[model samples]
Target: MNKNTTIEEVFQNHERPKKPGALNASATFAWRALLRIRYVPEQLFDVTVFPIIFLLMFTYLFGGAISGSTGEYLDFVLPGILVMTVSMITMYTGLDLNKDIEKGVFDRFRSLPIWRPSVLVGALVVDAVRYLIASTIMITLGYILGFRPEAGFFGVILAVLVLLLFAFSLSWIWTMLGIIVRSEKALMGISMMLLFPLTFLSSVFVNPTTMPNWLQVFVDINPITFVVDAVRGIIHGTDAMSDILMVIYISIGLIVVFGPLTMYFFRNKN
Candidate 1:
C-alpha cells in the first residue's frame, strides 16, 4: 500500500475504547460522592447537631410538663428524635440531586462510559454512610443523657438498622422529587413542609391520647409513628413486633413504589 493508504489503515485499525464495567461504574460514582463528603464535612453538622439540640431542648424545656420528669421524658423522646434525624437526613438526597442536575453534573455523567443508573444508586449508597454516622452520634448522645436501652446492644443495633433501612427507602422518594423539582430550594421547602407535619402530628412530642379523637386517629396511622414506636419498643422493652413488621412492610412498599418511579424519571430526564 502507498504511505498515505498505510497511515489511514493504521488509524482505522486502532482499538475502540471499551465500555466501563457495570460494577466499576457503580463503585466509581459511589466513592467519588463519598470522598466529596470528607472535603465538606460541614455537610454532616446538621446530622450531628440537630439531634443533640432537639434532644436537649425537648428534654429540658418540656420534658417534665409532658412526661412528669425530664428523665422519664428523655426515654420516650429519644426514639422520636432519632427517627426525626433520619428523616431530616433523607432531605439532603433530594437537595443534592437537585443541585447536581442544576449544575449539569448529570449531563457530564451521561458522557461517561458508565451505567447511567449508577449515578443515582451510587449517591444513595454513599449517603448511607452519613446516615450511619448520624445514627451513632444520636445513640451515643442518648446513652450519655441517661437514656438506657432495655433491649441491650443487639437490639439497639437492630433498631439502628431498621431506621437506616427506612431512611434508604425514603431516599428514593426524595430522589424523585429532587429530579422533578426545578430548583434545590424548592425541593428542600417542599420536603420539609411534608416532613414537619408528618413528624409533629405523630406521638413525637406528646402522647397521642392528649390530642383530639380525629387527630389521634391520624397519628395512629402515620408511618412515622410506627417507626418511632418500633424503635422505642426495641429499646424500652415495649412489645413492638407488630409495629416493626408494619414499618418493614411500609418501607418495602415505599421502595417498590418510589424505586421504579425514580428510575423512570431518571431515564426520561437523561
Candidate 2:
C-alpha cells in the first residue's frame, strides 16, 4: 500500500484478522483492567478507604441508637454495611468505562478483531476483584470490632459469594449507563443518586419497623433489602433461601434487560 492509499483501499487489500475465542478475548481485556490497577495503585482508594470509613462511621454513630449497644448493632448491621458499600463501589466500573470512552480507548479496541462484548465482559470480571477486596475489608474490620456471624466460617463464605453475584449483576445496569451517558461525572452522579436512596432507605442501618408506614412499603420491596436480609440469614444461620432466590431472580432480570441494551449501545456508539 502506498502512502496515498485510502483507508478503504488498505482495508480491501488486507486480510481480516481471525477473531479470538470469547474466553481468550475477555481474559485479555480483564488483564488490561488489572494491569491498570497494578500500575496506578491509587485507583483502589474507593475500595480500600470507603469500606473502612463506612464500617467505622456507621457502627459507632448508629450502633447504640439502633440496637441498644455497639456490640449487638455490629452483629446486626455489619452484613448490611458490607452489602451497601460493595454495591455502591461497583458503580466505579461504569465510571471507568465512561472515562475510557471519553479518552477513545474503546475506539482502539473496536479496531481489533476480537468479539465486541468481550470488552465489557472482561471489565466486569476484573470488577469481581474489587468487590472481593471490599467484602474482605468490611468483614475483617467487623470481626475486629466484635461482630461475629452465627453461621460460622462456611456461611460467611456463602454470604460473600451471594454478595459478589448480586453486585456483578447490578454492575450491568451501570455498564449500560456508562455507554449511554454523556460523561463520567454524569454517570457517577446518576449512580450515586440511585444508590444512596437504595442503600440507606433499605434495611442497612435500621429496621423497617422503625421507618414510617409508607416508607416501609418501599423498604420491604427494595431488592437491596432482600440482599441484606439474605446476607443476614446466611451469616446468622437462618433461612435465606427465599431472599437469595429473590436476589438471583432480580439479577437475572437485570442482565436480561440491561445486558443486551448495553451491548446494543456499545455496538452502535461511534
lDDT of 2 at 111: 83
RMSD of 2: 4.7
In terms of lDDT, model 2 sits at 0.92
Candidate 2 has what TM-score?
0.93
Clashing residue pairs in candidate 1, if any?
none
Off by over 4 Å in 1: 1-13
List the lowest-lDDT window of 10 residues for candidate 2: 10-19
List residue ranges in candidate 2 displaced over 4 A.
1-18
Q: In angstroms, how far off is 101's CA in candidate 1? A: 0.8
